[model samples]
Target chain A: MALFLVNVLDGFVTGLLLFMLCSGLTLIFSMMGVLNFAHASFYMLGAYFAYQISLVTGFWAGLLIAPLIVGVIGALIERYGLRRVHKYGHVPELIFTFGLALLIEETVQFFWGKSQLPFSEPAALDFAAFAIAGNAFPAYKVFMIAVAMGIFLTLLYILTKTRIGMTIQAALSYPETVQNLGHNVPLVFMCVFGVGTAMAGLAGVIAGPVLGVFPGMALQLGSIVFVTIVIGGLGSLWGALVASLIIGWLQTFATAYDITAEQVLTAIGFTKPELIWDHPLQDLWTLTLPQLGPILPYLLMIIVLVLRPQGLMGNRES
Target chain B: MNKFNLMMATALAAGLAAGAAVAQEKVRIAFIDPLSGPFATTGTQGLAIYRHSVKELVNEPGALLDGQAEFEMVPFDNKISAKESLIQLQVAMDQGIRIIAQGASSGVANALTEAVAKHNRRNPDDPVIFLNHSAVDPALTNDKCQFWHFRFDANADIKMDALTDDIAANPDIKKVYVIGQDYSFGKAVAAAAQRFLKEKRPDIEIVGNELHPIGKVKDFTPYARKIVGSGADAVITGNWGGDMVGLGKAVMGAGFDKPIYTYYGATSGITAAFGEEGDGIVKLVGAGQVNPAPTPEAQEFIEAFYVSFPDLDFGQPQMANVAPMLAAAINEVGNATDIKAIAYALEGMEYDSIVTGKTVMRESDHQAIQTVTVQGQTPEAAFEYDKSGRGMVAETVVELASNDAPTTCEMKRP
Candidate 1:
């Protein structure tokens, strides 16, 4: 039971971190009608920027300034690069972002080199906030949870309660109508893209210390972020949150348990085959839950895609 | 004008002939490893170490026999894929490079060994010799051994033997957990750990054994929780690179204060990532001591290497021996072209390694036998790694004689 609780907390932390990335991605996709392939790269830039800034001005200053820098760069890319490619259609936009991702990764490697940076959690949050089952959950994880929740609530408030949020949503489906009302639709799109990328950057700033900042970090989490947004519903923030948490719990619980196919087979009254090592189904018999932990998210995504083309909370079909 | 043209043609002809002569005296070794992708750091570091080693051990005056031959490493990025490695091997061979050196992945190593073996059988007149520096899968030197391939690093089974011996001496470590990347080398390490521990310390119980995907895991906290829940007193893993660093962080973060035994706990940004947090908790079994140099000459060599590449420590001690040993074989045969003669010369060869003392190339399996040391991170270490202020200090030394494991290789000589 104690172990289960630890898994829950760990899973929550993992889920929130995913949400931090997915939230921005979903917003960009919804507002621009173009899926940004380089969203995770923005997150990576956040970490690297924070690392550099932290070296000079400390972690707090990096946390604030790094995301703003990312936001500015993102706005520039939207204005110059993505805006030009937008006329050619979604495929071109995707191709542009994809190329941008590779370029950013190379640029990062050029600057930081291909090694794990010694970026660690600040000394202030070094101690364990609490312990369960003899396991200490660091205060840094709690901070991550708080930041993610704050972003979620603030995003929810802006989207539902604010006039600018309503205008942004109005522009999403009826850009002509919103532009006729004297609102700069192109500028809105650029700002939304910038803000979306800045959120990803914020995720990276907090995650870099925990994940061990490196050049390959974006690649590691890139596919998974897509999976989360896809499974949650392409443009649904709520879907992103639910799917992220589901993935987090699924992976953590799968790893925590040692359930094997052999046990399941035995429970169903199947006898163990003699010389099982030579059997055709030997691999199946030896397969364990933990071994499948990393692939569980993809498996879930496949199941969701097959059953419901639209995500659980998403209104539109992907 | 006609006289000037004739003089230029003669000069060009003479220069071409001299260039051909110099090229003949140069032996080029194709370094097939990942130069891009996530594992690029390890590969790049290995290449740098090899280049530096050649500069000091083979290129320096009186290093090789008569200094008649110069060794060069021509790099071909395999992208850490077996298929790509095979392609690189073909490209290297096409360039008339006879010697192949690689060691980042055992899967890649296995592919190259098979490819080299087939290439040798089909093209005996033009064969390639593989020089493995750091891939430690036991099968490469055991059932899957090839006469054309040579391993400089100790195999997984031997390192496990040394590790298990250290664990056996510690009475407090009764319950142990084994985790590794789900691959040939990782499986070999886990299997060896289980077998060696059972043989040496029968009373110890293996509480948990798990295999996670190599380089795919983003968070190891769940795995760490499992270990903590398993009630294991100690943990053993053969993880390296980012995986090692991630595991170390998760384990330490989870508050499992017990010692974690590893095959590669130090170097490659791992030591730096762990920093003061891993001091006294993380331990590694490897070839030679790093903090306190094995010999005075090795100390000088390490110091010089640091001066050249300040960010990198002299991590792979086996790399220091690769060029010198290859040069010895080349000089003995008086030529680098005869692959068979060089193979025979390298067989049963004994050389004094500045880093690991006396080392022997075992004739039966073409595996190098050298002293192994079990070290732990400490601030008292003579040399700090990655500016971490903590370095690996040797806690125990297992000499070359006792560090031998029986090989199942059946040599098929040409």
Candidate 2:
């Protein structure tokens, strides 16, 4: 029973992290309609920036300042780099972001080297949060959960209850109509992109210590953010939330329970199994979520695309 | 009639000279790794070793590869992709590189093996010989073993076998928990440990078996919980780099309060991340550190490496040193870079190495029979080892295993 609760909590925490990253991606995709493949790169950059800032001004300063810096950079990229590429159509835009992601990863390697950097836990949150059924959970995890939840709530408030939020929603649905009303649609796009990237950066900062800041962090997490967005429905924040929760929980539960596809097949009374004598494929049965974590979000995205094109709570029918 | 005969003899002599010149030319050796990706550090290290060895062995004053002839270490950055490795290998082959020293990743190694095997079947005389120094997959040297591929490092079985006796003898170890990265190396180590424990000490309860992906794992809290709850006396793990360090820190912070036996052993990579957390952690290691009392050859290698790269610390220097040793072996055996000749020379060849002691590259599997070192970390002293009652000193802990033990290859030596 305790193991089940722990798994649930783990899923919740993981889902919250996914939401933090996917929410920004969804907002940007809604407004721009150009899937930023480099979205996770921004998150990685945020973590690196936070790590640097934390080194000088401490973790608190990093948490506050790094996101703002990331936002500014995101805005700049939209205005200068992305705007030029937008002319080449959606395919070009996607390709540009992919190239940008590759460049960012290389740049990270140049700066940080290929080795995993030492990102220690903050002194204050170094100890255990509390013991549950003789198992101690680290206080840092509790802090991560708090921060993720806080970000989610704040993002929700901004998107729903603010003047900028209304403009963002309008621009996502009908850019021409919003532009006809004399509102600067491009400006909204720039801001949304910046804000979305900033959120990713914030996630990076918070996750840097735990994940161990490296060049590959973005590449590993970037596709998952896309999965989260797809599962949640492209532009719908609520859809993203539902999808993120589902993905996070599904992955955690799947891995924790050790329920494999083969096992499922076997459970459904498939007697006389054809032992394929395949080594590597046979090795796949032993795989779990953490093992499959890098690819899980993509799998979910494909599933969503095929089953429910509109996503969990997606606004658009397509 | 005399003038015609003289002219014909001169033309024949010219043709013979051309053939000799072609035979004397050095064959190219390609080295590929993730020079641009997140795993570029491993690639860079591999590149350095290959480059250094090629330079020392092929381009030196008394060179080996082509008898004072020049050969290049054609390095390409695969960026940690199986597809990219294939592309890079083709590029190397296109550029006339017929020999390769493979990088760290098993995926890359497997890709290269298939590509090379296909190439060799078509042109057997001009074949690509892969000298795998880093990839520790047992299958590479076992069931899926290739004739052209030769592994240099101690495979998973050898390393596991080296430590099993010591672990089995320990009375304090009642229950063992196995945790590894959910990859080839991890699964192999976990499976090997389980098999060995089952066969040797069936009474020793394996309480928990936990695995997380190599780089995908962020928080190790729940996994730690599972381990602590397993009522384990000791933990046997093969987590390397970030995972190893992060888990160590998590284990310490969570207060697991048990002896952890790490598989990567006393590698500098692990220590660089989890400095004090590595304290009291027992690890199976290969190269002895320079700070502790090392062999005379090891001291010489360190000094030479320091002169070449003043910024390099002692721990990483062994990687650099391994290159020169490999070079020296090549020089002693073959005076040509012909893969066949070099391959023949390397078979059943024994060399006194700076890092590994009495290294013997076997004729059968081409697996090197190198001395193994087991060391335990000590707290209070930064990066200091406790070799007292631990039985992990150079004289005490280092064990030399025969090549016949792990290798399945039946050789017909030239």
Best by TM-score: 1
Model 1 C-alpha RMSD to native: 2.5
DockQ of 1: 0.73
Tens digit of lDDT per residue, candidate 1, span A186-303? 9999999999999999999999878888888999999999999989998899999999999989988998899999999999999889999999989999999988888989988999
The Cα error of candidate 2 at residue A264, in Å, is: 5.5
Q: Please provide, for model 1 over B37-96, each residue's C-alpha lDDT reduced to its tens digit, 9 standing for 90 to 100.
A: 778878888888898899988887556657777888899999999999999999998899
Q: Which stretches of candidate 1 lie over 4 Å from their true place?
A: B1-24, B401-404
| lDDT, model 2, position B138 | 77
lDDT of 2: 0.70
Residue-by-residue lDDT tens digits, candidate 2, B1-414: 999999999999999999887765564567777776555556665565555544543456435443644556677888878898889888888887766777477878878887877887787778777777767777777666767777777777776666565577778889998999877889898998888788777789998776777767655655665677677888888887667766776666556877777755443244545555555655544433344435765556445544653422333323433344445546665544455666666666776655666677666676767766555665432223211112223322444554457556554332
Model 1 lDDT, residue B106, Cα: 90
DockQ (CA atoms), all models: 0.73, 0.34
Q: Which docking category, incorrect, acceptable, medium or high, applies to candidate 1?
A: medium
